[model samples]
Structure formats: structure tokens, C-alpha cells
Target: MNFKTKLLAYHAIAAAIAVIPMQSMASDVEIKYEKFPLTSPEAQQIWAAESNDATPLGEEKPWAMIAKVKVPGKKDLVVSQLFSSMHCGGIECPIKIMQEGLVISEGMACDAYEYHELSDDHEALMACDAIIPLDLK
Candidate 1:
């Protein structure tokens, strides 16, 4: 082919690539959390230590779940939180973030939580009931 035609074809290819999204061009990673019932003896121990037995009837067990978080190029994270009909009252409950069975973070309250891997840093987003979302680093 002539130089002019080859140059035009190269320019067209470059233009198409430039318009494509950066994410689609790279390996796409899905970030999400999965909840599984907390039924292990270890989980029970954690609940007993943190629950404080606030409920009027001590017999009322706190509903709990372990959240497994998946992040790109990282080990799965384990989160412990109370849920269902029996959770700590108001906006706060005991929350724990763990990796490899080791606690990385512990907090009093977070009805909802999310982790973000930003361009230059990482952060956790937490929201309490009836309260504004907090951007935590």
C-alpha cells in the first residue's frame, strides 16, 4: 500500500483506541462483598465478647454474618457484623475487618460499608443508619 493510505489506516486505528474506555482496555476487576451465616464457635465467641448482652432477654441471640470482600489482586477480607432483628440499637454496632484471621480494623458502628481502591490511595466508605456516609481512609 502507498504511504498515504498506510498513515490514514494507522490514524484510524489510533482514534478508535483513544475513544475506547481505559477500563475495557485493561483487565477488569469486580469488587464486591459476600455475606455468609456466622455459625462457627469462633464467631459465637466474638459475638459474646462484643454483644454486651444489651437485649432485655439474654436468650435473644444476635443475628450475625461474616462478610467476605473480594478486591483486585488482594486476599479476601473477612468482616464481622450484626444484622437482622437483633442488632445494636441506633446507628452503631461492633464491626470488624479482618484478613488472614487477623483484625485490621475495628469500629463501633457501620450499617453499610464499602472499600474503594482509588487512583493513588485506598479508602473505606461507611454509613450509619440515619446518618451521612463517611469517607474513611
Candidate 2:
């Protein structure tokens, strides 16, 4: 083959090799968890059931505090605390960590939470402050 022809063929082969990885990486899909607002009926129903009530109590139903959370290398989660209900009062409200309409963790007390910078690719779920472990085991 001529010098120019060989050079052109080498470049073409290198370009094809580079494109392979990019194509494979593009095919990798990450499933994101669905988000629900605090006032949404879906969120309210979940909390109500967790609180052992058929429906939320008081005029202000869905009194739970909800926060969208994302941890590193983890699926998105919704953290909720029923701050006002017959089963709970004051800072003793129960904490629930949920994802995809399923409760991952619950029955922990949370006075509040510390949210990190979610906009800058930081972990959205930081720490649940003032949490007292209910299970002694």
C-alpha cells in the first residue's frame, strides 16, 4: 500500500476503536427513582399507613415532612417524618426512608435532617440529626 493510504487506514482503524467504548457507555442506563411531593396523595397515603391510621388525621392531613434524597451510588429515596399525628407528637415523630413506593427503612426518630448540596452532585441525604434508635437490638 502507498504511504498515504496506509496512514489513512491506520487513522480509520483508531477512530473505529475509540467509537466502540463510547457506544457501549452510552447504552448503560441508570434507573432513577420516582419523586413524590409531600402534599401528594401518594405520599400522604404511605405515611398514613405507616402511622397505623387508615387516613391522615386532623384538618391538616399529610403533616409529614418530606425530603428528596440521593446517596452516592444509591437509588433516589424519599425521607419522610410524620411530625403531627395521634401516634406521634413533637420531635418523636417516626422517620421513613422509601424508594419506588417501598419502605426501605423506618421506625427511627428524627428531630431533623441535614441536607447537602444536591445541585452540585453532592449527596442529597446527609444525616438525620437527633435520631434516637428505637430498636435496642
Name the best candidate (by lDDT).
2
Across residues 21-136, which tens digit of lDDT does each residue of candidate 1 receive?
43233222332444433445656644656455434224544555566655455676665666433455564666666667666666665545443212212234233222222232
RMSD for each model, in Å, please? 12.6, 16.2
Q: Over 4 Å off in model 1, which ranges?
A: 1-39, 45-48, 51-60, 83-87, 112-121, 128-137
- lDDT score, residue 101, model 2? 65
Worst 10 residues of 1 by lDDT: 128-137
lDDT of 2 by residue, 39-112 (tens): 56856666655544523445655465666654555566666666555656655566666777677667745444
Worst 10 residues of 2 by lDDT: 128-137
lDDT score, candidate 1, position 87: 55
For model 1, which pairs clash? none
Count residue pairs with overlapping backbones in model 2: 0
Q: TM-score for each prediction?
A: 0.47, 0.45
